[model samples]
Target: MPVRALGYKPVYDYRVDQLGDQGGAQGSILVAGTWYCPSMPEPLIEATSDLHAGRIDRETWVAHIAARKPYRLMPKESKDAEGHQRMMCPAEAGKVQCPLKPRSLGRGVHLPLVDPQPSPTRPLKVCRQRAITLAPEEGAEYWQALDYGDEQWQKIYFRPRNSVEGHANRRKITAWLDSLARGGQRPVRRTNRRRKTKPLGTWTPTGHLTPAT
Candidate 1:
């Protein structure tokens, strides 16, 4: 079964009859209205254009697959023997491995960053100015993790089920912190509007209040 988060809807598989004999057979799927070779990484998709332009050789194109980090196929509810959360690569089955590969596109070709970005979701805007408070103990861990700046830190802050805002105010605080750690500018806050008022009183010639206005 296709994973829910991927939003993958399997379409017809490519065959010789549909795409002609030269085109390879690969199952195609739609993701948020975009078609994809479910197993192909975004880098490889980009490499296809470079290959067509004669910038990268076929040998280098094939090597890109070996460098790809394995896809996460395990269900979110699944856990390893030690009761720790587990992830897996689709191609390697149960094994977990790094997905970065060395670039071999000869001179002048550049590869995308090895690490993927964190969630694109932004935190909810606050209605008022308030300090971001975190648990005293976890506060240190969060700061240290943000300072480290790696996938491991992301795993800690952006854990599954954390995307939702519940009673835990810390989630939103950590998200904003994570954004800063990833080089995002601190969000600008809107200034509060000054309250309007009517004239309060009338004054006599001596400057003493005589009556309410």
Candidate 2:
């Protein structure tokens, strides 16, 4: 496959160290066509529900995060200690109360917005133009950029290109998107689990059979 768009099914990466089936880690290629990180949702549901139900305040929630194993608020110099960049971690995190600041919470910690800002700049290697639902009337400026100089095109889309075969790849992707838009085919969400039911009994010479028999 030449870096085509992802289907809507989730992909599971199995791990042995973690207990439970599939190691409880799963990821999905979302409708926007981005690969989401694999995560275990089991531990989060209760805490999330409590937070949303207003049973716990933000301060309490922050404390809960620190309480989790392997996520200590200990000093960076401590053995196996890890923390957000430039944030201070107390030498005796458990013994003393650690002060909470906006910067202390690292990435992926969602908070209610008091002031909204534009999204942070993507890493140089990441694509600025994401997979999106195509519009039939999208202009030539958009399509032409897909065939730009190799370096510029790679930066924009975050993919490698060939001098001879690059145009063909762009055309293929463009045509695929166009067909989807023209046909009004929306992306459908899919789950990884297959349905299971008891097998129907088979007839036998001895007698009518139940599934157990």
Residues 7-70, model 1: lDDT tens digits? 3322222222222112111222222112222344655544434555677887775554334323
What candidate 2 gets wrong by more than 4 Å, as runs, is: 1-45, 71-213
RMSD values, in order shown: 24.6, 21.7
> Which stretches in model 1 have alpha-carbon errors above 4 Å?
1-42, 72-114, 118-213
Among the numbered candidates, top lDDT falls to 1
Return the lDDT, model 1, position 176.
60
Model 1 lDDT, full chain set: 0.33
Worst 10 residues of 2 by lDDT: 23-32
Instruction: Report how far off residue 160 is in candidate 2 (Å).
Output: 24
What's the TM-score of every candidate structure?
0.22, 0.16
